[model samples]
Target: MKKIKGALALLAVLSLAGCGAGSPSSGTAESSPEGTSGSGAATALEKVEVGVIPIVDVAPIYLGVKEGIFEKEGLDVKLTLAQGGAAIVPAIMSEQMDFGFSNVTSMIVARSKSLPLKMVAPGGSSTGDTKADFASVMTKPDSGIKEIKDLVGKKVAVNTLNNISDSTISEAVKLAGGDYKKVHFVEMGFPDMTAQLAAGNVDAMAAVEPFVTISEADGNVPIFSNYAEPVDDLTVAVYFTSDDYIKKNPETAAKFARAMTESQKFADENPEKAKAVLPDYTSLEPEVIEKLTMPRYYTEVNEASIEKIAEISLDRGLIEKIPDLTALLPSK
Candidate 1:
């Protein structure tokens, strides 16, 4: 509880500084679930809605709906795009969304706050490739920042403070024999981070895919893969729902999980298909979309990675206790 309050206090200070966390304010593009409308079988399908962000991590779900995988499971999944997980969590809690896709760190924080959310599927993972992962610790050329350990005593830009950026980066630094507590974190949206990096406002920026690729195009060098180190093939994010919602609709949840697992398998096997459907839901240009780094779509979550994140969260004082994975994670 003390740690949660400290995080909220930090949020207040950051919000007053003009650079803060991204909230859900913009309208989302609505995509039709396969066989939900066109085939005159809409009535037979179980209408489902999920909150998502317009990023490379969500390609599997989009591809699943596109390839009729969800339809085959008797579920009609509608995706609603939000600015970030901050918005999606609320939507799920309020019954506006049936499920949501969010990073494990944020979900852990939510669970620590006693929010009755539960992970239902493995949503995103790192490729375990330092040079070509979905996200990286990006620094400008000749910045003297070459690795995660060097980031100690330097200012790092994260979309949100006290979240995964601090967790993963600190862990990598600790593994490299550096002091994790010496690192400084600042809050700014991803869209604004690259410019800040170029201007030398931040020493290093936790850059995610699309941004990592875009920043690299502008000559910024990657120090290391942010989601890869400390644990290779780390689970970066997850698909989840309100605990109450799951309890009331176990069958629906099971069907969604089965369909999503199939979706992950399909995306894992056909990486091009994942890229091909990006333009259908996002506003990114063809050229940029073509070069975006995609995350691993695994049907199973890396429990060790999740546990490591929980321990880091406890260390960061983001949570008073490590969350109970058995209760929060999907059944194996």
Candidate 2:
């Protein structure tokens, strides 16, 4: 998969406007500390650079851009595209980007390692309504695979280890009264997994987004869905920045958050708006985009969810220990 990055320096230099203003300018500016809230929402920003992945879940960020929400925030915003959240942390930490959409788990994991990260806003939540967004474990009709437990010793595919795919796999294994260690786990991207399954290379897949919707349409029945299991309220998408950037440019940071929050409002109030604007930033088909699962739009990180994911990470040994949740979230 390709990695995406946005230009932080360029966005810090643009002019600001109100929400849904006019044509947004893309500029570069000197770095400064970002805002906390209220007044900071209207604060001027030199430039606001944001990194985004192509998943339909992050449609709000694109909607904000398409609807001129960020432009109206009295700021100039620049968007950098990337393949996944894994690519975003490094750029933010390196000070190459100002803010990026990410899963709270990634931020928690990074924070546990002292990566100097903070989640400034809530992105969205994957609920029953958004259950179809996940990469799921599906079985062919009458495959006798009644539950995740049935997959014991059977072949299963995941997008990556310890990611949403892996997390879902772990949850399913536990839910089905099976053990993760007993299953044969394979790592493959969503596109490759379907073909691999067709060729009999895999038995099941813990898929995400369009793949899940597509898989169901192809006749595979869902054995279990990650979003429906209530494993963790872990954010699948959020806005994050490195600690250094927060310390250096607080005002700029707050401005970026304000702009993002405005975008989130647009997305929440107008699903069609997201459906209309998301194609510019993602490869999802227009029809597929409209059908994809979209979560409640939030611009702040949920501390409780972050804490829960940290515990899960510790249990799975993805992180050495649970992180101090308070330190990982944006200051109130």
Candidate 3:
């Protein structure tokens, strides 16, 4: 996916807007450190760059910035918006980003290839909450596609091929007694999936919020929640960094984890606050943000959920083999 890098660069030029530095590694302004002096003065903060996608699932990261949680933990985080996991992986590998938000499938694939990456924190997860429609398989209302089985011999758009979107949809199709191999998978960006489906360019689309909300508003019908069948309470994505970076900057990594954890707790308790920051990072309107299905943001890494994802990837032949999952986590 070398082409993905160029695509991400173009997308960044067109859509990048936030409180972060213009580039992934451009932020260097530091603040006083964690503790205060006898006179109640704070110490200096360590500056770090984090890469993310402009999706509602990353609201906690933006919330962390707005709430000063990272600053309080002696970290100055610069959040860079990348197109997707394919683009973010290369950035982390090259040290362009200190940490990144990526799906577990990508991380596992990287690890299986011997890339020194480690999961530092949870990005987003599925709690099997029926009321919470974080992701879904959506199609135009008049497409005559009422169920997953109906997708046979049809085109399905996913953000990436052989990733979370494809894996989930494939399992769902199988459970519905449909031939997954008969479904054609098209690679498209999440922001553009709804439009493609609406325009009859693709028969169906696997979408995550706030696009899910957008598509529904545009009269698209959701066949089912994307995470409904395969694995319940799955950890969809995670915050990860390169082992070399972590080895050289252990303290900064820990501070980032602490700050993110605090941000996760705040978001879990105050969904309104999490939703409030979406307008700042994403192009979604305030009305859309208000109605978007927010992902379950957790602080602690779920090894079991990640393992299941790796197993699924192997089963689908996305990865040659499963890597040692524990070795890919941050060292205790």
Candidate 4:
């Protein structure tokens, strides 16, 4: 592990501007300035910035910062929060961010198009326990969307089109005897889904935490747990970096992977500690944080889980073909 002086100060300032308390929209990438690398090993430490979505699944990254996990690895980590992988992936490709937290579906699509991205570590995953809800399709109690079958011919909102939500929901709908092709999906941010559903703008919305917790608290009824039917114990998201970063800074990438691995293990074993750091990085209330369904965080990149997602993406025509999974992940 290597340490660089003065980098923590910059991280502290970015943390406030990007992930200030009670301000969700403030965490977007506009708040993080592009990092400049100096010369030598110290330069790598100073230039380490990770782009993440402001969601509960990424809690371990915040916890790692607070718990000195990244610091112990001799890396000063600047957290850049973005609304979606669509934004983060482009930044990564442009060399604006060293690493990014992204869903596997999006990364698969990116690799399929020869985007030069590689998964360095696991991000978050489903528990596969039907009782433990990480993501779901929900609607207003009065919306009459009692089952997955009801979603057909309705405008269901998803955070993204032709990604995880679209693929999973389509499979779930099919499993429930619904015509998956007839279901219409509209792209909407998670933060706006609840409001849109309430206003009768969308019949149902696929939501992940803490929106799921927030919507449930607001009396919305969940039609089905998105991870339950289509794929159980799914690897939802992963931490990735551009191929250039790995080639130029292998040591830095390895240190980051090790630190994140420790953080993921800590998060998995100590849910309360992981939850404790949420308020520092997200706009979710403390009460809501306590109630939100936590995603399973793991260290080792699961090839099988990723292959399943890629297979689904291929089936849905989201990607022209399944990209080589072995090359997409770093050799451990």
TM-score of each: 0.88, 0.80, 0.86, 0.84
Expressed as tens digits, the lDDT of each residue in 1-332 for candidate 2 is: 11111211212222211100011232222223332357546455456777765555667877776665665565566777655576667878777888877766667677888787877877766554324534357767666787777888788876666655565567567666888677887876655655576677888876665566566656677777665454555455578787788898887778778877887877878877776765565444555655565666756555666666667677777789877777777789
Two-way lDDT contest, 1 vs 4, winner: 1
Tell me the whole-model lDDT of each prediction, alpha carbons only. Answer: 0.79, 0.63, 0.74, 0.76
Off by over 4 Å in 3: 1-42, 330-332
RMSD score of candidate 1 (Å): 7.4
**TM-score, cand. 4 vs. native:** 0.84
RMSD of each: 7.4, 9.1, 6.0, 8.5
**lDDT value, residue 84 of candidate 3:** 57
> Clash pairs of candidate 1?
none
Q: Rank order by TM-score, top first? A: 1, 3, 4, 2
RMSD of 2: 9.1
| Model 3 C-alpha lDDT per residue in residues 1-332, reported as the tens digit of each score | 23322233333332222111122222222223365556988765577888887766778888888888887786777777675566778889898889988777888888999998998888777757643668888898889999878988999988777887788788778878999889999986665666678688899988776666667777788887776456777777778898888889888888888888888888878999999887666545566666677778877777777777788889889899999898886456
List candidate 4 stretches off by more than 4 Å: 1-47
200-291, model 1: which lDDT tens digit per residue?
Answer: 89998987766676677777899998788877678988899989998899999999999999999999899999999877665556666677
- The best candidate by lDDT is 1
Tell me the deviation in Å of residue 195 in model 4.
Answer: 2.6
Report the poorest 10 consecutive residues by lDDT, candidate 4.
13-22
